[model samples]
Target: MSGSLTAIALDAVLEEHGLTLQQLAALCAVDHDWVSRHIEEGLLTPSQHGGEWRFSSATLLRVRRIANIERQFEALPELAALVADMQEEIDDLRRRLRRAGLE
Candidate 1:
């Protein structure tokens, strides 16, 4: 229920992706607990309401990226999340730079 993941936007993304918790776990090759822990720790957010967890494409990408970072370097979850956050920021900046013809 935080960040820029508005329910309306998520609904639109969900309509396209239609991914469930299990699907996300399978795609990321991780388990349910991993995703749950990330959500509980505020590293990820679920839908604004619902007993089930519905994921968007962005969530899938983020989970895989964070999991890969943690496995590859044996990094802690917090560190991995931090790295993911920085990477997202860098990507956003790059997009802005490209739009401004400065990339």
Candidate 2:
């Protein structure tokens, strides 16, 4: 866990099938209803495999972030999703800059 190789291996494992709804809910400390509502509201989108929804690691992180923002500010789902979108954009931009050796 302290090494880059360990992180890479764990990421590879997670990439195999992504996370189930139950796993994502539990890990994010949110309930199934919360996740379902987000899906209904278009805040989160999960891929389907074998007729079941599967969330990627990125989705898990997004859920956690939105939950945090809602809890901290009592924001509605729409507002929270917007904030999460902005935050994700910032993160993506930072990564791009870093990759380009500009950050």
Task: Please write out the lDDT profile of model 1 over residues 1-103, one tens digit for every residue.
Answer: 6656686686687766568888889989999999999999999876642567778767777898899999999998989999998988998899999999997
RMSD of 2: 1.4
Question: How far off is residue 4 in model 1, in Å?
Answer: 24
lDDT of 2 by residue, 1-103 (tens): 5798897786676677889999999999999999999999899999998999988878988999999999999999899999999999999999999999999
CA RMSD of all predictions: 7.1, 1.4
| TM-scores for the candidates | 0.79, 0.91
- What's the residue-level lDDT of 7 in candidate 2? 74
Which runs of model 2 end up more than 4 angstroms from their true locations?
1-3
Pairs with backbone N, CA or C atoms under 3 Å apart (clashes), candidate 2: none
Pairs of residues at least 3 apart in sequence or in different chains that clash in candidate 1 = none
